[model samples]
Target: MKKFKVSLLQLDVKFGDPEANYSNVEKYIEEAVQDKPDVLVLPEMWNTGYDLERLETIADKDGQRTKTLLTRLAKHFAVNIVGGSVATKEDGKFYNTSYIFDRKGQLISQYQKVHLFGLMSEDDFISAGSTLNQFIIDGIKAAGVICYDIRFPEWERKLMSTGQQILFVSAQWPTKRIEQWKMLLCARAIENQSFVVAVNRVGNAPKDSFNGHSLVIDPLGKILEEGATDVEGIFTCEFDLDDLKAVRGNIPVFDDRRTDLYF
Candidate 1:
């Protein structure tokens, strides 16, 4: 039950410009690695912030560029990375994809946003991803989900039931719904008895203003570390597996779940 340190890259993403966003990510990664964190996380759509109309044009082609940089940095820093979601184009279709890299710089998992936000018109532009992926990070079972995906408790529970210890969420959630983001993520952790490490972007977009409340919540629903609403900075925190065991042992939510009644 060793403790793991995490560094969250909470930065504003420029709308409709992949080049600027990529450059910003590179600069932030440089700063983040300096801390020598055990793991690094980024916000959703860091490459192109909800530039839905231009996704077909501005999206990363095959995600090669993003993969290259994330791989290089992960290898260089020898840190595990839960790369935030990026707008990636493949086979003439666009998807909001999240990539994961291990300390060895190997691509571990890729999850597209399974639940698209119709309110933001994401359904109109992006193809929904179908697979739920699980991987190991620093010997911890982990998985990544996009912004709106957290709303579906069943989806999160499904993954958690499959031995997922850490749930990494990358979001461009609107300021108006920051409360929902906070409540839902805490609920996800409390109900599932797992650590929830979520990162949200700060600053404004044409549709909504994002106030980064990037959070690191323990299985007991305690906010161990939280980012300010408008600040763009790297926030780091540490979590130990002992926390998970203590909480789960006390609550026994997983053991007490009514499996027969769960239809």
Candidate 2:
């Protein structure tokens, strides 16, 4: 199989301000499209940055606006999009949500954050997602998860069992624990034997600071591309499906797992 080029938009979202953040991210997306990547990714909370107090007022109503904007961009550029997580209002509650669009502008999959961050009081403001996020892009099985979701290995294992080769993570990780973020991401890629693409926001929030270490890791746990801590930029990397296949075949770790005895 031929390799696919991917771009990660590491943006600096203005705290508690949706309009400014949205406009800034729109410009980043416009610039990213110039690279003509197969898939373009954004960081978490691209719509509203940690404005949980005002979610009831600011959350996207049923994620309609986000879908419309991302779908239009996907169609216009003829590229797949893994839009970062947004504060989405459905029914009477709100959730941290992600939307995926195909090249033809079709909404393929939508995932709400399953693991809410209690330290930030996310559970108080948002409803947790009930289902796993799995989709196929360009005939390749892929999965996506939110910021804190990476802490759970079982979730990624579940997706791997379903034949996912590309794992996309959108995060708003804090600068205080950047080492954990990097270690966890590399571990996930190494253990799952799949390509791991993570996009994290930069700049400071109201109560916390975020260091943008957005990166793309190969199946062998090699860092292909990474972004700087202080700047807003787009990083691109090419991933070869054949290389992933060879790595998995040579190791056979998944095939040798003793799942039947684990329970």
Candidate 3:
């Protein structure tokens, strides 16, 4: 179906508390499902919010706990899920990973955040991902990326070049740069001619305060839906996935690329 609805969990992540975060996610999912959206998205590090120093103790072991929970929920609700980035430990190294599950609860995509934010000390603890997250959801081609990845237009363009109609971004963007978050998401939509569904966390961590301006933007750079700053809630928006074709056709930016010049 070209028409699809998406719901975002603009959550307030509990610092270093995976158990409490898990319970909160369950509760949020129970409420968000009432909208019956085709896809449900969670914010980055929902399992552990920027609790860097303690990642060794709290990160999900090979993402087992996260995968099990997301799989079960996706199957039970019969909805696609973009299980946002979590701190994961695998083979003694830690990574910021994101998981995507289909309606059948099958794992569709697993991506580790490639660009680590040195400003947040992410570089010191998390190993950068070397791959891209591209997959099909409910017959629609889409991609997923974590917080800092949005800053790199080339990275996003590389994914969009593969014909993905929608880009799903999960983040814990700080309130200090909330304006940049909005501007960047809109720019991504306008430039790539694809829908951008971004979910940012709310509330505060020990070092930063998150302003939940979670957004759903159309290909033409129109803001479909946005959440309030510092308010924890579910935001839902619907759009026609096929509209990207018309937008791209009108501009033909992708077709006019000079691949020979750029390296």
Q: Give the TM-score of candidate 2.
A: 0.97
Off by over 4 Å in 1: none
TM-score per candidate, in order? Answer: 0.97, 0.97, 0.98
- Identify the superior model by TM-score, candidate 2 or candidate 3: 3
lDDT of 2 by residue, 168-248 (tens): 999999999999999999999999999999999999877899989998998888899988887789999887888887898
Ranking by lDDT: 3, 2, 1
lDDT tens per residue, model 1, 114-171: 9999999999999999999688987789877888999999998888886678899999
Candidate 1's displacement at residue 50, Å, is 0.7
Q: Tell me the deviation in Å of residue 227 in model 2.
A: 0.6
Name the top TM-score candidate.
3
- Number of clashes recorded per candidate: 0, 0, 0
Clashing pairs in 1: none
The reply for model 2, stretches above 4 Å from the true place, is none
- Candidate 2 whole-model C-alpha lDDT, 0 to 1: 0.90
Cα TM-score of candidate 1: 0.97
Which ten residues in a row are the worst by lDDT in model 3? 254-263
lDDT of each: 0.90, 0.90, 0.94
**Local error of candidate 3 at residue 237 (angstroms):** 0.5
